[model samples]
Target: MGLNIGTITDACQWECVNTGTITDAYQWEFVNTGTITDAYQWEFVNTGTITDACQWEFVNTGHDL
Candidate 1:
């Protein structure tokens, strides 16, 4: 049951400039043979930079097989 990105249920697109601000910082596993892969090291930003800087991740959640 491995997901390889293209099999996702939803897809979206956007734009950005500063894409390096986001980073992967953590990970974990559950008792039900499930895993958690943290993607975005920094999830918060100022309102001033929200429009100008569009840092993003190639993924969000409900993933990691």
Candidate 2:
């Protein structure tokens, strides 16, 4: 249960595709709860599971204030 990008203004591209098997893997932050300051706007690609499946990922630059 992740992927909760709560604040991202424009220049956006989000994709989280899961096709089979995903119990729990919590570690997603591209502005997950609050505050965002210049982290290339927004770009996340969680291709199911914990990490790396189809590539295109970036979920941590600096924010939560």
Candidate 3:
């Protein structure tokens, strides 16, 4: 089975679990592939102006999935 989020439009929350044999899924990400939005974008303080800054890097090499 699979989950298809192709029809979702509004804000919502969802979760997924792995039942396959990928036991070493120790890394995941929340990559924003869209334009700079307020709720999910990073900014810096320069001249009191906020703009789209560099993306944050996250990694967990020692944790198990």
- In model 1, which runs have C-alpha deviations exceeding 4 angstroms? 1-13, 16-48, 63-65
Per-candidate local distance difference test: 0.28, 0.43, 0.26
Q: What lDDT score is found at residue 50 in candidate 1?
A: 38
Instruction: Point to the candidate with the largest TM-score.
Output: 2
Those runs of model 3 whose alpha carbons end farther than 4 Å from true positions after fitting are 10-12, 23-65
Worst 10 residues of 1 by lDDT: 24-33
Q: After superposition, how far is residue 32 of candidate 1 from its true place, in Å?
A: 34
Estimate, for each residue in 1-65, the C-alpha lDDT of model 3 and write its tens digit: 22322222221222223344433222212233333223322221122212211222222233222
lDDT of 1 by residue, 1-65 (tens): 11222332222222233333433222211111223343222222223323332332234344344
Model 3, position 34: C-alpha lDDT score: 31
Better of 2 and 3 by lDDT: 2
Task: Report residue 3 deviation for candidate 3 (angstroms).
Answer: 1.9
Which candidate has the top score in lDDT? 2
TM-score of every model? 0.17, 0.21, 0.21
